[model samples]
Target chain A: GAGVSQSPSNKVTEKGKDVELRCDPISGHTALYWYRQSLGQGLEFLIYFQGNSAPDKSGLPSDRFSAERTGGSVSTLTIQRTQQEDSAVYLCASSLWGRNTEAFFGQGTRLTVV
Target chain B: GIQVEQSPPDLILQEGANSTLRCNFSDSVNNLQWFHQNPWGQLINLFYIPSGTKQNGRLSATTVATERYSLLYISSSQTTDSGVYFCAVDHYNNNDMRFGAGTRLTVKP
Candidate 1:
């Protein structure tokens, strides 16, 4: 709608349980990106979706992390069998295009795996 | 893959003072952006300068693409300006944005 919106601002999950984080990009934005930030760390690239193109998942740390964008608007990141290390803030951002454009970020989802 | 490095890992300034942050990249980039991460962990876009310079209120930024570096200037800093500043870049051939470790700014009253 206005800016990027992320669901479940904060989540607490069991060590081995799977968790899903959602993102709603701004209207008509064609590029969406997912990033992870650990405490006192820089933002780490996770995945990127540009329009209808195949997603770039090169930054995904492991097979346990996967994401999907529906209709090029909303995206969901699924972390399977979450580990304690997966606990961090997941941030979503969107831009009119992937290059030469400014990206707007959401408030992020804080995931805590115990 | 491009490498981004931000200098002066930490900075502390009195309100109304001025400060400058630096970001250096390893390769040519088509997109470069500056962001401010507030206390709540929200990223606020500051500048989208791949080259040249841009200004917004009390803040301004300059990028020398030829030199593979960018500079952020904060004039008249305020307590509310306390946060972490990051600079990100996208390689000319790729869209993946790489970010610097960031410079933490603490503006004191």
Candidate 2:
């Protein structure tokens, strides 16, 4: 089975620009999540979606950061007006459900704000 | 919100040796997971053991939910085991998981 996959493994953008990172979860896995990792901040959740229910966007750092999951399989994380501090590796993960389940992860999109 | 703490912070071991990593959480959790982030920035799920013990080849994990801690064991370690190991726990109904600082492991031949 294919594991979780992300697009644009690396992205470099100017400050105040918008960037979108995509994630494809594993087949039959309805639970998808996004996280960010950097030298200053450890791994932190960004959002999670279960089926079509409203996503848990509590982890999003600011209003400029948003994510959407479509068809309950693919998810896109968008960072609007990116800043230098936003530079980090955005990771995607998926599990079977919100219950006790193992989440598979993607290689992640390394975003660098210049 | 939940707080997770990993012990040792860093460890160095020779090939064929054994090591144990620990994770402690501040609150009760409904789910707990272990992950390994390689140098390539790939997050690999190691286990989803909220409770009990599970073993995969030379790697094993034990979670004592009552104690609010988990242990990951690696026996006969290899150079490939070098990486940062993290323990993340999701507080009940939080929908978001909190991760520990992680324990860095260095395997030397």
Candidate 3:
């Protein structure tokens, strides 16, 4: 992809529904990151992936929030049984390297639970 | 855990004005980044100033890693600069990144 791309630019779902958000990182980029922003993203680091290595989920708010990367190019974030509080803009980014590298972000998925 | 702080939680300036935003972290960092979130909520990377200074068009950033602070300078600002600016850093020992609440700038035309 030309840059980090996220699917379902905007989503509206009812409580208790499960929603899946997708992120396609830049080719050859090894690091993928996810962050959640409410009303706007407040810059909270949600999860990150470096190759096939286990993802760092320390920032996930709860078990309801989980993500997986297929191979190393694409990732998905699934929020199960969504709650009204789950409404937020979920962002995905990628970088050619690690922390020292600049990360490129997607437009983000705006999830709204009513 | 490392703490990140951004000064002037909120700012309003006229287009063509210049402003400086600051970020302070609690510990040594190998990585430091600045991002701008536009009205539509998209983050645009401004610089990777883990150390030293770098400039891109109207924006320039400097980080003194040893001192644990970074500064972002926006010169001849425009209405497009209106958005939230964030600073994020990784601890010397961790790969995880943490962020400050952010500085919201509103540039009026």
Candidate 4:
């Protein structure tokens, strides 16, 4: 892919439903990141995945938020029992490596929990 | 955790005017980048400057690593430049990139 790509550009789910957001990173990139942005707020770090090593999940807001990256190429963010406060934009980004590399972002998925 | 701060939370400029946005971090960083989020919510990478200076067209950036601060300069601002500018950094040995609150720029024509 020429750039990072996210799936289901928009999602509307019930308050108690579960939603999954997917991200396809650029080819050969070794790093991936997931972030959340509420309306009128800055980007909030969610999870980060690097090549094969243990993922840094320190940023996940709660136990309901979890993510997985398979084969270091595609990634999925799962939000369980979505709440009204979960309505926001989910962004995905990728970089060549952790150090001294520029990151590119996807268009993002707007999740609306009704 | 490194603390990133951006000054002049909001800026209003007229077309053809010039401005500078600042970002300060609490610790040494191995990666620093500038991004612009347009009104439609697309984030575009502006620069990947951890240290030193670089320029591109009407935009330029400078980062003094030792000083732990970076500056983004916009020359001859245009209406299209109206957006939120964000500064993000990654600490040494830490890949968890953090972002500043961002500076909102409004260029009026």
Q: Could you say which candidate leads in DockQ?
A: 1
The full ranking of all candidates by DockQ, starting with the best, is 1, 4, 2, 3
* Candidate 1 Cα misplacement greater than 4 A, ranges: none
Cα TM-score of candidate 4: 0.98
Docking class of 1: high
Candidate 4, TM-score of its B chain: 0.97
Displacement of residue B51 (Cα, Å) in model 1 is 1.2
Best by lDDT: 1
- Estimate, for each residue in A8-113, the C-alpha lDDT of model 2 and write its tens digit: 9999999999999999999999899898998645788889899878888888889999999888888899999999999999999888986577778899899999
DockQ of each: 0.88, 0.76, 0.74, 0.83
Docking class of 4: high
Residues B49-91 of candidate 3: C-alpha lDDT, one tens digit per residue? 8999999998999999889999999999999899999998877
| Superposed Cα deviation of residue B15, candidate 1 (Å) | 1.3
Looking at model 3, residue A113 earns an lDDT score of 98
Give residue B70's lDDT in candidate 2 (0 to 100).
99
Q: List the candidates ranked by lDDT, beginning with the highest.
A: 1, 4, 3, 2
Local distance difference test scores for all models: 0.96, 0.89, 0.90, 0.95
Comparing 2 with 3 on DockQ, the higher-scoring candidate is: 2
Task: For model 2, report DockQ.
Answer: 0.76
> What digit string (tens of lDDT, one per residue) describes model 1 on residues B1-109?
7899999999999999999999999998998999999999999999999999999999999999999999999999999999999999988766678899999999999
Residue-level lDDT tens digits of model 4 in A1-114:
999999999999999999999999999999999999999999998999999999999889999999999999999999999999999999999999866789999999999999
Clashing residue pairs in candidate 1 are: none
Q: What TM-score against the true fold does each predicted structure earn?
A: 0.98, 0.95, 0.96, 0.98
Residue A107's C-alpha lDDT in candidate 4? 97
